[model samples]
Target chain A: MDPVTLLTIVVLAVFVGFEVVSKVTSTLHTPLMSGANAIHGIILIGAIIVAGQASDVWILAVALLAVVLATANLVGGFVVTDRMLHMFRARKPPADTNTDAGTGTGTGTGTKGGAQ
Target chain B: MSLLPAEWTALLYLAVAVCFILALKGLSSPKTARRGNLVGSAGALVAVITVFLSVKLDNIPAILIAIIVGAGIAAPIARRVQMTQMPQLVALFNGVGGGAAALVAVLELGHTDDPWVRVAVVFTMLVGAVSFSGSAVTVAKLQELITTRPLLFPGMRWVMSATLVAAIVACGFIVATGSAGWAIALLVLGLAAGLLLVLPVGGADVPIVISLLNAFTGLAVAASGIVLGNVLLVVAGTLVGASGTILTRAMASAMGRGVSGILFGAFRGGSTAGSTTQSDRPVRSTGPEDVAVLLGYAQRVVIVPGYGLAVAQGQHTVAELATALEERGIQVDFAIHPVAGRMPGHMNVLLAEANVPYESLKEMAEVNPEFKNTDVALVVGANDVVNPAAKTSPGSPIYGMPILEVGDAGQVVFLKRSMRPGFAGIENELLFDPKTTLLFGDAKDSLTKVLGAVKAL
Candidate 1:
């Protein structure tokens, strides 16, 4: 493809893609944007791959550095996001009381913390 | 090898710009945000594919591998993250964008002998690194893996100032010398500066921090795009940066703080030492049966859930109780405060998970008026948002923070373990009110018992 034609196709795609994205409502935003943002990190990988393949020694060195930095961003971003998600995970406290149940029970005044 | 015409390329660029505009517009309303995302992504796809079409790379496999690897990691993580931690997740994602831009700039600098590219590259690296680290610290503070309170040292402001100055000086040297050594030093200093900048911010300030960092990422990405001469990058980054800034300012104002206060860590005084009336006056508590009796006889019951409800994982029990009450022909509604729980829409997500009907969940604005008609306002582990101090006490840390008007309800039943103050550390005056009855225990157990008692009655 000619440079002009290829560039034109890319630009057209951007325009249509932008329009479609704008249609997403506030309700869909949190989930959609989150997914979108994660995908956006692909740029790092792209830059790295592009850099890794450069013919010149200088380009190759630059690409290698890009790979390291971008990888840090990707890894760090994933780790933090995962941790944050854990915070929101619904965890139900087990219905245990101040008593043993292994031998069918022991001492208990009831789980004292059970809101009166 | 190129076969495309110039006019087509120009048209495609215009189309991409349109997609960007549409995506932004759709983001304005929740109903359209999904479609907007699709539109924006399509534009990105077009841009990427067009790049492929124009320039045939020798190693297509490497490019494909990069794409696959990136997606494989990000997709699962995003899928696994829950809704409640979205704010921090957002911060982390923004950080990645900034970091990526910085990395790209650094690589370009390493490869290029041109002074202009080198200068732009340095700027991108500084901005991106700072944005990334700053966002990371904000996420840490918000997640409470690190303390939400400011990590202040004596003369902390001066220290932060000095670090920033050093970073700027280092950046200057890197640009002047065009050496990787200076660049490496500058990166470390910049990272430190970012941490110092965000460390003093408390958890309450995280929303603003997230927004600001988002803006920083956008701007950094945009600068990198300019350096790389990528039009799509420039357009996308600019839109995100601008929108992020606007959102940040709006959120800061909502918390009654300014941008400067947010930046300088001056607003940490929100947690200032204030006298708390620690009432040892024993709470007149009731059992599940007694509480159930009142609720069963009541015509209207409003369920108020807070962070405690979340901590105890009592939403299902709460919903069951609501169902039981409804079965007995008693009216039950969930009253959700805007800033309830840790994040926006936290209550909604919890309730939804428990299969509570969406119609039964009412926002503060919609439910406050009904409190007067409510027979019993059951507060489950909620504190700051329901505290009457928001309206009654000027000196209270939560003063001016909007609260639920559950006080107007005929009787208030508090399901609490103890009188520990909430995130704001201010005692709930509602606890001591004559009309309020404290039901002290585990929220889930209390709720389950209440349901049982109501069913029995």
Candidate 2:
């Protein structure tokens, strides 16, 4: 394919992706972005391959730049994701018992004939 | 050499853009985000297929292998993560996208020896490195692997400012001499600065910080795309960058925080300390059976759930109790405060997931008046929101925040673990109310006992 056509198609695809992303509210933002990020990683790999085979110095330069940026994104994303998972794993503090009722204190209200 | 008509190509791009718009629209509601994602993905797939068809591939297997491997790892991780952790997961993923864009920029520059390309490579490298490092710090903070407290050092601000200055000088040096070493050093400085910049931010400001980083990533990616002349990259990056910035601003405002306050960790005041004064008044206590007796015969019972419900996984049990109450021919309703949990609409989602009937749930405005007529108002694992402090104390951190007027009910039964303060670290004044009876235990355990008592009645 001609460079112009390739560029055109790529641009269109990205626009579509953006339109989809823009529609997502807070509820869907995270998941949609996550899915898109994976796609970006795919793009990164492509850029890397393209860099490896480039006959022109400019192409090689661009490819290397893409690879660096993409790698950072991939690694950083995983780190943050792993960190968030920790929030769910916190050990709930044991229940404080000093405030427990039904003890000898008559201040405690009870149903008639309620056991201590 | 053109393979496709320009008009058709433009049309296809327009279609892709429409998909993005639709996907975003659908994403506004949780119920539709999944479908929105599918539609957005389909657009991406179309783009990928177009690219595949346009390019002459000598080795298609390599592309297939990469896709399979990447999807295999990501799909499982995505499936395993719970909804609560979704934000952190998003932060991680967004960081990766930023990093990827930076890498792409670097590769694009490496392919060219042109001075302009060299300059673009430097910019992309610095931005990408910083974005990656900043995102990592954010993730660490969110995960609690790193301290949520401000990791501030004396003169930390000056040190960061100096590093940023040095980076700028290094960028100039790289541009002047076209030296790759200088560029690399500049990137390193930016990365270090990114980490330092984010590390000092407290946990309270993390959501904003994450969003800001997301915006930065988007901008960096867009810059890289512009440098490489990838229209797709530019368009996608711009959209992300713009949207992320808007979101960051909105989130900051929603939390009543400013960007500066979030950035410098500057505004830690009375709010952080929580409510002022420990109430000296003693709390009224109640037995499970007595509470159950009151509940069993109550003409109307209102169950108000808070963060405690999420911590104890008590939604299912709460649902069961509601069912039991309804079985006894009592009017039961679950009153949900908008900001009842850590996030908005948190209580609603938890209850919905537990299969509680939507008809039983009532918003604060809808049910606040009902408390007057309610025979028993059962507050489950809730504190600050239902606290009388919001009403009585002008000095309280939660003073101005709107709360459920559970105290107004004829009889208030609070199912709490203890008299301990909430996340804001404030003692709930509602505890001291003569009308309020404390049911101290695990909310689930307390509710179960109450249920038992009710059944026994």
Question: Which regions of candidate 1 fall more than 4 Å away from where they truly are?
Answer: A1-116, B1-24, B27-31, B38-47, B56-60, B110-120, B174-177, B263-270, B274-281, B327-331, B357-360, B389-397
lDDT of each: 0.65, 0.62
Q: Please tell me the TM-score of chain B in candidate 2 relative to the true structure's chain B.
A: 0.78
TM-score of each: 0.76, 0.71
Q: Candidate 1 chain A: minimum summed lDDT over ten consecutive residues — where?
A: A100-109
Q: State each candidate's chain A TM-score.
A: 0.45, 0.45
| Per-residue lDDT of candidate 1, residues B354-450 (tens digit) | 6565567787778999999999999998987788777887665456666789999999999998877766667777888899998989898888888
Candidate 2 lDDT, tens digit per residue, B235-336? Answer: 555555666666666556545456776676433443444534556568898889889988899989999998787778777678778878999999999998
Candidates 1 onward: DockQ, in order: 0.10, 0.12
Model 2 misplaced regions, further than 4 Å = A1-116, B1-13, B29-32, B55-64, B112-130, B174-178, B267-307, B323-349, B356-414, B418-436, B451-457
- How far residue B91's Cα lies from its native spot in candidate 2, in Å, is 2.4
